[model samples]
Target: MSVKKALISVSDKTGLIPFARRLVAAGVQIISTGGTASLLKAEGVPVIGISEVTGFPEILDGRVKTLHPNIHSGLLAVRDSEAHVQQLKDLGIETIDLVVVNLYPFKETIAKPDVTYEDAIENIDIGGPTMLRSAAKNHAFVSVVVDAADYEKVAEEIEANGDTTLETRRKLAAKVFRHTAAYDALISRYLSEQVGELLPESYTVTYEKAQDLRYGENPHQRAAFYREPLSDQLSIGNASQLQGKELSYNNINDADAALAIVREFAEPAVVAIKHSNPCGVGIGADIRSAYQKAYEADPVSIFGGIVAANRPIDRDTALAMKEIFLEIIIAPDFTEEALAVLAEKKNLRLLRISALNEPAKKVDNLFRVAPVAGGALIQDFDYKQLEENEIQVVTDRKPSEEEMAQLKFAWKVVKHVKSNAILLAKDNMTIGVGAGQMNRVGAAKIAIEQAGALASGAVMASDAFFPMGDTVEAAAKAGITAIIQPGGSIRDQESIDACNRAGIAMIFTGTRHFKH
Candidate 1:
């Protein structure tokens, strides 16, 4: 078989030079456009400019570069069928066997706080996807590669089998479609947010595989990590494991819970999370004291729970943490000595993430995906956050100063617990949490039970609405003096009446914090 023709274009020049060199060694004729063409030429690769291939100069602000018939016909031509081959020959169009491309950096361009509209518009690519789709549409006879990581595999295949097989071409085409769809989603979401719309009718998103895990939620299932095409800010993708075994799915979830709960505290503190609920939490003079007190709050739960510190990890704090069997520890910074102390564990995941205590700000990437019966459900992640000042007194009796402190602590704890969440707190320590319950009353009872004697002076907080006063009656029975919740249930008045009659102080923030 003759050497195949390959089209190459990308905004990210990473790995392009070596990839193009290998392709050249395989005797593939490389064609590229714009900066990619110039870049390849500078690297001494035999690359033809798209304008030259099409016999048309790039026009319309470079928008009309690759939209011509020469490029599309070349990529879409069928190489196997005699009739299609003769038709392509009659049209004098070369059959393209491979296409490799990455889209324009639109999201990165607009991420700058002071990015101009002209800059954003200029960064948008017009012809890259057109060529990618054309190549993918003819996958039966053409291979489409969207990511540079696949370059090595493609090169190896051509070196061994003389060309990528039909199966490889089809798989590459699948990646092409996914790449284009994700690219479009990012563009749509950006434009919608720029115009202040909630959800658009159409969407596009782009993510590349980060790594393939040993297994998924279970050892038997398969799992892989994919991150957004853009930068990861405060996400699990960027977390650093200072020491630890390979993270299980449950470990990641619990670590996320630990981090999420600590985000609720404006003041520097330490929170220990186990099974997605705060088993221990405290405000302290410093992180070391806070962690110590939090550990003392529930030593049993501290055995393997994740710990999140709002302050930096110092030598003293790290040494203190070393005495525990924590799965993960997160803080803004870690001292050299602190990291050294942590390094001794050899299996503890240590993450240093800044900007953890920032006020709730809306994120553009909030689309959620969940599998349904026939398809999947996609919606924006709820951005509601309960500010300390926004809470309102609903009951006739107002909470005393002592009760207010515990109420605030419980409120913060409840936000991090899964729904139907019920958190009981005394001062800064979380005494009990009934998370993932079926009903509000049940949640209250579970938390009260966990609190035991500690429930006497503690305050209670709920993540969502209270259907009736049964929860209030339950709290009163458990000796809960103050309660804070999002009041939007069908029987809100009944709950309020029960709170008033039972002499239990209650307040509503009108904001629910349901993790599930």
Candidate 2:
């Protein structure tokens, strides 16, 4: 039983070559299916095709090759049971010591726009899952490997100890179950979109372990990131920091806001975000021009803020950004010279990502999670994207053409900010933002105070309905001429009355954008 029999099949052939060679040198009987069998044979490893072992020709495009008793019974048998051993001997089945399999590319197959229904159906791997589950259920006797990245690790373990530990086998079994579950989740979520019915509530998702950070939002807490299998989305979860230190939970949260906001502009743009709100944003001719305008929009608030840009970073743009002490900088690409310049500030995080790679659009009303005492809370994320027709103006004066631009910009900026947020905008740039305040009025006061003389001609945007007339009064006193907010509070009439009395025009969007 020196280096007994093992099965290998994978869609991701990352480290399989060297690993298969090592197992061959150890005298393992290599059995594989379809492309994997051909690949191992090409590498000079002695390999047998599953068709040979199963005595069944690969029919229907090689889908029915590995579903026989000879393959699965070996993996599923209990090694220590006399009956299991006698049954295997009676059936002429060799014991399989290992099963390495990664599922078919169902998710990747559907990612193409023109994939046919038959194509998707063909990728639904039946034999692969059967093999994975059979090995996982008999973990005490067989080791299972789902990730190609695990091949080298398992090889190393066997080389060092002559066998994989029971603990390692159990851990690998856990990974196999997770892999099958995630594969099933993709199939279910995809089919749900096809027929438009009540998607069967049975679904699952898998996230690969990314890393354990020093802390979560605070230094005393513990945190780790699990990256989703869908790597095409434009989330901070997909971002790779190319330089500097690891990101804190707060860094990821704020950087996500910055990236989302910068992606909105049709032209080149820059957005500086703090506390999940855009402290400043601008659309201009070049990166430097946009960065300058955004910086001037709210210099005080931009301190230590995360910056996102829509264009490739150049030497001039990086040089201008170097003048500011920022927490993070993100762009699609950074020139070699620019990276060298940015490398000077070793603590600042630099992230590079393609804009086209983000999700097609935000899936509205997705699940939102919040931790609570002794339990956790989950609900739908905010689904309020305002349209011009949904806006109801209550005052006699329609907003001036100039004021309308600022109002729209502020409204968009406030949506990404933490709840109880207030944003003031002028000339399409945020002049001040008050975020994470305990109450609406407190947030309004902070924004106005930050604006100071700048508030005289600014427009204000709020995340939700103001609970009282005091917040409106505060905005008016600070010289805000126009305001946008969700009008669903109990005292909405009073707030509207206060705005009308102050000669400030107000619009009700009937939408709430609460980030927290």
Candidate 3:
């Protein structure tokens, strides 16, 4: 194959002039549209206008320029077939051996703070995608270029071998389809938001790779991080890594879990996470005491775990953290002494996320998406908080004021735990947590055992209703005085009867917080 004619149209003109110059020097005719043609001609590049090739003036505000049969047939026709070549000759259509195009800035335009719907709709590129798709579909003969980063390689290939190789064209075609798919997904997501459809008739999500991690959950697995550009919520993706080496996949996951649990409190709070489960949590008068209490709740589990705080880390907290080995520490800000002290630990991952102080909004519209074997599952975020009126006393005994406070705190912590999950709390701090167990009773037993003597007066919270009376029996044996759960299981009455017999106070939230 030999280079003959090329069509170039782009919104981003980086490296366009030099690329077009190289093509022109190699005896390839340059045909362009609007701004691209004007710029090339100004630079003495000898470009032919698109209207000259199609013999039709651009109409409808330049939206109807490149949709003619002359353009499509030139790009889509089979080059080696007798019928296709004859039809091209009979129709006086020239073959377009190359196409260089990029879509309009729809994502960038919609990302503005106050962009209107009309503004976004107008920026959607129709002719660009149409031409690129046609060229990509016929990539057996026509080479399609969508990214400026490929300019040097493409130009060198053409200059070296007169035309791009079949392998190169196939790769470019695949790239074109992926690019268009992501573009369409962005349009779909934005329109769905405008129409107030959290999940549309057809849902598609697109993400860009942020970085390649050292490994996934294990050292043998490969992994990378991807991020959604439209997400506004405070998340690990947006956190600023102030220090430390590249974070592993497990580190990112654990840090995210810690941040989510820490955000559940309005007052100064600290949460320690290990293996995507909260090992300890505390809310107190100051950040130092909160961290101290959280660490003391389960000092053995806090080793090498990620810690997140909902307040600025002061000098005292830093001093306490320096005494232990921690993988990561994230907070809204750090005092001068704290940062200096933390900086001493060269390998500790330190992240500063400003959104930690800002309250979460758009609860009703936010979604959490998880991928499965065949497809994905999409559901609304579990932002439900424990309201005073929503709590109902189901057992004969009512929780005391102090017990009620601990029950509410435990409920919030339980929401972030994996099912079957159990949490024990006293004085607004988590004493023990058991997560991701196969059975409810197993989770209860693990939590009770971890609490040890602390379980004597601590309140217990279950992420879901107890399926049997065994969990209630176990809690009662451990001297758990108060229990909080959704209370809608088929064996709910059995558990209630067991609690009453043990003289334990129990409350029903009527809302399950299953986090699996």
Query: Can you give the TM-score per candidate against the true fold?
Result: 0.89, 0.87, 0.95
> Model 3: per-residue lDDT, tens digit, 72-162?
9999999999999999999999999999999999999998999999999999999999999999999999999999988888899899998
RMSD of 3: 2.0
Query: What is the TM-score ranking, best to worst?
Result: 3, 1, 2
Give the per-residue lDDT of model 2 (tens digit) for 378-402.
6654435568899889776778888
Of models 1 and 2, which has the larger lDDT?
Answer: 2
Worst 10 residues of 3 by lDDT: 357-366
Task: Judging by lDDT, tell me the better candidate of 2 and 3.
Answer: 3
Clash-forming residue pairs, model 1: 182-205, 184-204, 185-203, 185-204, 185-205, 186-204, 243-347, 243-348, 244-347, 244-348
Report RMSD (Å) for each prediction in the order shown.
3.0, 3.3, 2.0
Report the Cα lDDT for candidate 1.
0.81
Reference-based lDDT, each prediction = 0.81, 0.82, 0.91
Q: What TM-score would you give candidate 1 relative to the actual structure?
A: 0.89
Q: Could you tell me the lDDT of residue 203 within candidate 3?
A: 82
Looking at model 2, residue 338 earns an lDDT score of 96
Once fitted onto the true fold, the runs of candidate 3 whose alpha carbons sit more than 4 angstroms away are none
Q: Give per-residue CA lDDT, model 1, range 300-359, as digits (tens).
A: 888988898888899999998999799888887888999888999988888877765553
